[model samples]
Target: MKNVYLDNNATTMIAPEVIEAMLPFFKDLWGNPSSMHYFGGQTGKHISTAREKVAALIGAEPSEIVFTSCGTESNNMAIRGSVEATGSQTKVITSRVEHPAVLGPCQQLKNKGHALTEIGVNSSGQLNMADLRQELTGEPTMVSLMWANNETGVISPIDEIAALVKEFGGIMHTDAVQAVGKLRIDVKKTPVDLLSLSGHKLHAPKGIGALYVRKGTRLNPFLIGGHQEGGRRGGTENVPYIIGLGVACDLAAKNMDKEIKNVAKLRDKLENKLLATCPNTSVNGDRANRLPNTTNISFQFIEGEAILYHLSDIGIAASSGSACTSGALEPSHVIRAMGVPFTAAHGSIRFSLSRYNTTEEINYVIEKMPAIVKKLRAISPFV
Candidate 1:
């Protein structure tokens, strides 16, 4: 069976171009960038060029971009580093719907005596900025909200939120892991203090990512050892993955304009078809201003896991918010925190598209998905 990959938000297939870019680093150019020897120094040149590429894509200075293992490390480094640098503050503020990368580290800060304020989101999954404003007034704090939500594809008003933090003299961070390739990001245009991105989400290989720290921001190091990343992060670099990420960034910058329109049209078409044919259905996020390539839907009468299994059997790759948190009884925290009805929470499915997805794939999934949902609903006692 020809598989259709609709789970781009979780991860993506590595692009051929990215893989080609990385191949040389693994075999031919293998050397420690920190070493001053001639063999190692050649690797430094390639790493520097890659850094500039990553920096250019995000509109940040090459000096400000620090290479890290993945988005989670970048987020942890940013949040922990900022609070440690600003010893005067013991409070952190973030939303209820951030990816675990952002929220998990902040939750850890509580053990160190840092107070955490968890703000709520509306049913549409947009952060409650008004509540955020109320929280910011109380103390010196750092605020982290994802640029786009992972489960629902809801694009938060990060520019406005960043400005609100500035008014209160607070540092702002945003996890742009899902938003990097799907949306246009210019860090210079937005004065956020920190932002995070992952390579795997953008057709690059996993195990490499970057953190953007605005100039003049003081950050404590996450991994302390060598002077790599200008002492921001330490340890040996993953040269092959970094090279792939650089090439991926270059490609994303090139094709972002046309791909955005094409994918958004396809995403909307798939979503509309499902909602029209399926009964008791609803979308999970704000209808307007979501990631152009993602659609999350809920089928009320059945569990999300059963729907996903049925779809998978037909070569359709999709994810259920409920099943992703398997081994645990609780439903998706994101959906639950948004105040979605408990009845619909177990039924949420996320279908994320990438630039590589074609019209044929969309049509194929649309042809197969309705019947799958029907089959699952028939057996579901909830129906």
Candidate 2:
């Protein structure tokens, strides 16, 4: 009964190297970065080093990086901060399939009298650029779209979107939490105004994230307590986790090419095998432009929660896009946005792989998943 975890999108196992890099900060060098003494100075230097590492991973300047609690905070800061900085504008634009981090803040703003335009996606889960162009007709305060879909792993044309936002005189931001390590990110190349990433999504410990602000992007501070994070964010930094995240980013930069090729091969093998073994199944999203290490498959006429329970019995971990697991009556917003049929949308399961995942683990899941699905469907009333 081996434990095979494929739910990297929810969180990932912290890498041993990252833990090793972080241990010293927790043990001997636990000083407030703002302290005036030598101990604080040493810790502060490490923070600066960590900042450089994170910035390098995304092709940003160290000055442009601002550490925050997690991806949610970063997203909020990027959305709310940019809008507030540009006081004259009153509109924010984003897509229908963004993670709740971005969507939640936008909805909150909409409730507070700000105009919010949520662009729709096609049946393939790709954004309708025409709709985006129409929304950008006005002087939008900001446009926040995700670089990748967490459930479907669909990669968006963020570089193109950023260019459009620039033309329309709107600030551009991307929640790149799921895309940061798995894909190549060069802020210089993309020219986005702001970007958010979580450390936990890339084999670093949780509770640490970063926001990248392009130089000269006017953004009001989201958290204003102290002068830390260059007066952009104000809190005692989570020193150890920040150091861990930096190591993880360095590791990601070094290993991304190999990880992409190997993980994609493993993911494709498992997905193809599962689809072949099951009936009335379909893959979600545009398979051609998806994250290399993810596959979302829909099992028609079955409940995803029931399937999850069956898989759990075998020590296999996966995530469901179904509304049943999300405490809702409707299916996944991502699947629904893509126009996935009601029959299939309720049963979509997301399997996200990591660099640590091996062919053996994928094969093990492929061997067991078909039987689990068959058993569940046999008892499903909808079938």
Candidate 3:
């Protein structure tokens, strides 16, 4: 069985180059970045360099980048911290299709007496901008929306959304964990106040992430302790993972064009083949306005977990929805938000690709999927 990984949206394999960059930090540069000694200073300089590299990937300044433990922490820092800084009276707005990281924090805020509005999405999983516009009124607001849907790969119109938020004097935050490596983001052009990114979504190691806080954004610190991450996030830095993340960012910037072209080609090939060959199958989300390396398909009359089990047996990894919500038996909130029928909703599978995927690997999955779907449907009681 071939080892094909189509679960990049969950987490990616660390790049060899990123590993090489991190090795020296683990063995030689094992010093606290906060220390005043020479070894500490040397490690601290690399953290600064990593900060710059992470900022460069999204067209941000080095000073605006705040290192966090992962994307969830970044989301929490942006959502909870911004609300704290903006005062308890601020209303929170987000979409219904957001990852649990964004939605979870927003829900907590709601429980704490903050006014929370969840904007709905269209049948194609596109954000309802009109709804968002309506909600932007009536209070000083903070809008936290995902730049791209993790399950369906639907890209939000963030540039327009951010501009609208600014027009209403609202703070805008984006969970760009899936979008950072897949899309070209320039924070200056978009005018978003805050954005979140995770390292593992790209080719960097897990347990490292960053938040881009725009200059002059009044964000209260999420973690309170010693002054680390410019007094934003307080903790000892993960030096090796930070260095790995920086190298991964630099590599992503250089190869983005090729990644967009090659990965999309493979994604399209897989999506198109499965839709054509499998009966009662349909693609989800807005095909024209989605990420290049993602596809969500629903196979009617079958359960997604079963498909995944069979696919895993053949070494082809996929997902039913966000890995964060994988164990829940219910269909994903994302698919349910799009109003997909119960028959299709429970059967939806997401295949997210990466720069390392090859044509041969894609072809192998394409060849194997139709048969698996047919067999599953044969036993499916819904059929």
**Candidate 1 lDDT score at position 360:** 97
Clashing pairs in 2: none
Candidate 2 contains a number of clashing pairs equal to 0
Each candidate structure's TM-score, on Cα atoms with residue i matched to residue i, is: 0.97, 0.98, 0.98
Model 2, range 1-383, lDDT digits (tens) per residue? 88999999999999999999999998999999899899887899899999999999999999999999999999999998988888745698999999999999999988888899999999889999999988887565689999999999999999999998998788999999999999999999997999999999999988999999999999999989889999999989899999999999999999999999999999999999999999899999989999998899999989899999888889889999888898999999899988999899989999999988888899899999889888888888877
Model 3 compared with the native: what TM-score? Answer: 0.98
Candidate 1 residues lying further than 4 Å off, grouped into runs, are 323-325
Q: Please write out the lDDT profile of model 1 over residues 3-46, one tens digit for every residue.
A: 89999999999999999989988888898877889988898888
| Candidate 2: C-alpha lDDT | 0.93
**Window of ten residues with lowest summed lDDT in model 3:** 321-330
Selected candidate, larger TM-score, 1 vs 2: 2
User: After superposition, which runs of candidate 2 have C-alpha atoms over 4 Å from their true positions?
Assistant: none
Cα RMSD of all models vs. native, in order, equals 1.2, 1.0, 1.5
Per-residue C-alpha lDDT of model 3 across residues 1-383, encoded as one tens digit per residue: 69999999989999999999999998899999888899877999998999899999999999999988899999999999999898989999999999899999999999999999999999999999899988877478999999999999999999999999999999999999999988999998999999999999999998999999999999999999968888998889999999999999999999999899999999999999999999898999999999999999999888888899999999999998422337776789999899998888888899999999999999999999989998988897778
Model 2 poorest 10 in a row by lDDT: 133-142
